[model samples]
Target: MRVHLGSDHAGLDLKNHLVAWLSEHGYEPVDHGPFVYDALDDYPVFCLRAAEGVAKARAAGGDDLGVVIGGSGNGEQMAANKVEGIRCALVWSEDTAKLAREHNDAQMVSVGGRMHSLEDMTRFVELFLAEPFSGDERHVRRIGQLDHYDRTRELPPLPESAIGLGPDA
Candidate 1:
């Protein structure tokens, strides 16, 4: 599989390390930016582009994914998710990393470099790559609803039990 990667200055080293690591682990790595660190660099540009690369690859029938990194990863994930068709998840733990893919079908993973040690980062990425989406009906349905909402700007209908007045009213 091909993986696209991007990061701000804070995550540049990690992104570089992962590029080599990913290639050694038998995946093609696409470095999206920060060829040379720019202290004033913005995260969204690279993150969005990386996510776009993955989305475009999928549209072309390629099995590509993306990883975005930053000091906190929160902004990067949010920006990546703004791109249509990109499901970017902020991953802090191995379980959450794997679950992002398994439950949300996330095509992009955002990691906070300041929050974890190198070993844990490696473990989290490995777990994320190893897991497969369960594709359970409810998960699929909910993701579909999110997609519908994204397109239609409509709120999900409330559950039946939540739609009525209280009995004591």
Candidate 2:
């Protein structure tokens, strides 16, 4: 898989480490980076590119993923999520990382550089890369709702069962 990475000065070290790790593990890592550390460099500048790379790859029928890193990962996740067709999840644990792909079909994941140890963060990424989205009917329906809303900017209507009170209630 092609893994696109982007990060600011705060995450430069971890991002660099991940780049090497990703390569050694046989995944193609594309760095959309601030090659040199600059305190003032914006996370969006790089993160957006990484997210866009994933979006474009999917548009061409390729299954690519992205990793956006920052001090807290909040801004990086926000930036990546702004790109159309990109589902970027902020993952803090191995379970969340796996669920991001399994449940949400996330194409990218955001990691907090200052929040965890190198081994922990790398393990989260490893788990994320290893998981596959569940193609169950319910999961597919949920993802479809989000995709529909992404294009139309309209809320999905509540189902009849959800809209009415049940006799058991």
Candidate 3:
């Protein structure tokens, strides 16, 4: 699979390490990077580009994924989510990483470089890459709703049961 990666100064080291690790593990790692560390560098530029790469690849029918990293990964995740058709999940643990893929069908993941050990963060990435979306009916329905909302700027009507009122009432 093609994995796109981007990070600011805070995550540069981990990003570099992951690039090497991913190659050794038989995954193609594309670095959308700062290249040289600059403390004043912005995360959005690289993160958004990486997210866009994933979106374009998937649109082209290629199997691809993305990873964005920062000090807390909050901004990176936020930036990635702004791109249309991108579902970027901020992953903190193994479970969250797996669930991001299984439940959310996330095309991208964000990780905090300062929050955990290198091994733990890498493990989370591995779990995320390995897990497949559950593809349950409910999950598919929810994803469709989200896609519909994204395409149409209109809210989906709430079900009658959810509104806590009968059809006549």
Candidate 4:
């Protein structure tokens, strides 16, 4: 797998570690980075590139993934999701990392550099890289809804039970 990585100054260390780790583990790691640390660096600048790399690779029929890192990972995740066809999940635990891929079929994951130990974050990334999407009917349906909304900007209909329960009703 080709894993694209990006990070702000806060996550530079962890991002560098993962780059080496990913290569050592036989995955092709692409560093879309701020080669040198700058305290004022922006997460979106790098995160968006990483997300775009994954989106472009996948659109070309490749199984590529991405990782974006920042102090809290919240902004990085938001930035990544702004790219078309990119599903980026903010993963804080091994379970969430695995679920990001299995349930959401996410092509990218965001990690918080200041939220956990280096070892814990590393484990989460490892789990994320190893998991596969479940491809279950329900999961696929939900993903389809999201994809539909992404392409059409049209909201899915409310459930029958809630159809007449709006504030206007």
Could you report the Cα RMSD, in angstroms, for every candidate shown?
A: 2.4, 3.0, 2.4, 0.9
Candidate 1 lDDT score relative to the true structure? 0.89
lDDT of every model, 2 decimals: 0.89, 0.94, 0.95, 0.95
Candidate 4, superposed: residue stretches over 4 Å from native: none
On TM-score, the leading prediction is: 4
Please, what are the lDDT tens digits per residue for candidate 4 over residues 39-154?
A: 99988999999999999999999999999999999999999999999999999999999999999999999999999999999999999999999999999999999999999999
Pairs of colliding residues, candidate 2: none
- CA-RMSD of model 4: 0.9
Per-residue error for 43 in candidate 4, Å, reads 1.0
Model 1 lDDT tens row, 32-151: 987788889999889888989999999999989889999989999998999998998999998899999899989889999898987788778878887888999999999999999999
lDDT of 1 at 49: 89
TM-score of each model, in listed order: 0.95, 0.94, 0.95, 0.97
Per-residue lDDT of candidate 3, residues 1-169 (tens digit): 9999999999999999999999999999999997889999999989999999999999999989999999999999999999899999999999999999999999999999999899999999999999999999999999889999999977777886778566534
Our model 1 lands, by Cα RMSD against the true structure, at 2.4
* Error at 112, model 1, angstroms: 0.6
Give lDDT tens digits, candidate 2, residues 10-114: 999999999999999999999999799999999999999999999999999999999999999999999999999999999999999999999999999999999
Residue clash pairs of candidate 4: none
Q: Residue pairs in steric clash, candidate 3?
A: none
- Model 3 clash tally? 0
Worst 10 residues of 1 by lDDT: 160-169
Candidate 4, poorest ten consecutive residues by summed lDDT: 160-169
- Candidates 2 and 4 compared: the better one by TM-score is 4
